[model samples]
Target: MIVSHPRRTIISRHEQFHLAQQALRRLDRGTGLIALGASLIVGAIAALIWLQPHLAPVPASIAINLMTIGIGAACLIAGWRRYSFHRQLRAATAITDAPMIDCWIENAFEGEPGVIAWELVTSQPDGTEVRLRQAQLIDPSLVTVFQRAATVPVRYVPANPTVSALIIE
Candidate 1:
């Protein structure tokens, strides 16, 4: 009789962080551009208000323009904050070094379509056991893949072992 073991897949924390940062930047870049466009539109509206006839109602025009400017400013601020967060995530990922471990699937279930919850357990270098339960949005069919995997890869920061992520790849 012959028994063959399944191949194991491991991902370094740096790679994971890089993937996360890229995803975040991709999502936020479009949002930031849209916000900037809105800001430009607001500026154009203010210019139009000033260019209108002198007999035009000034108070109402000023009030509307002020509101538009306020909204535009808010959008710009939000976009800047998102970009800042992306940079911070990138920096953190560059500095973090987490160990990869083999984790066995304890249980798995689907909360909704395209979402899976995985309960995993792994042992630390010191012989301590760590349990991580997380839910992620993925293809509904991936539940079977998780079940078939002999062992899943997990990475956690040494400083905060509780903060862990299930390696999807």
Candidate 2:
């Protein structure tokens, strides 16, 4: 559908970065809750071990603990990676007083590891509607960038025709 509005000031790159950061923080908090749940389970297991050491073999208890630790560690690593990528994305663009639209298209990195791209249609008065482009054909690295970029806002500068900045909101 054709959507139009007023040309408002675009959000700055710094603001987009802040937004991305906030998103990551939310993710982190969710993960923290998961960790807390796992800890409680582990605590219960420990109690079980203490109450009935002979019920399960020592090796089995050790394995359970190992698995729990491994999963927790993996989650932490993944969260760190997400935060780092967003930080890099924050440097990709600046802010301006351009209008943009918010639109969605298919998953650009459907088959790829992490590649995604948005078709930046023309700017409008209120906001922009960016259609997702070629969801099935995306590179892994590009997907990583796009994933973070998508979370942040975007703005188009008229000075250079095909160039736009990812507002760090």
Q: Output the number of the TM-score-best candidate.
A: 1
What would the TM-score be for candidate 2 when compared with the true structure?
Answer: 0.32
Q: Please give the lDDT score at residue 40 for candidate 2.
A: 53
TM-scores of the models, in the order given: 0.41, 0.32
Going through the candidates in the order shown, the clash numbers are 0, 22
Candidate 2 lDDT over 1-169, as tens digits, reads 2111112223333443343343324333245545554675576567556845666666666666667666766666665655544444444353433223222222221332321223344444556644321112223344334432323344444333233334432
> Which candidate leads the pack in lDDT?
1
Each prediction's whole-model lDDT (CA): 0.46, 0.40
Worst 10 residues of 2 by lDDT: 1-10
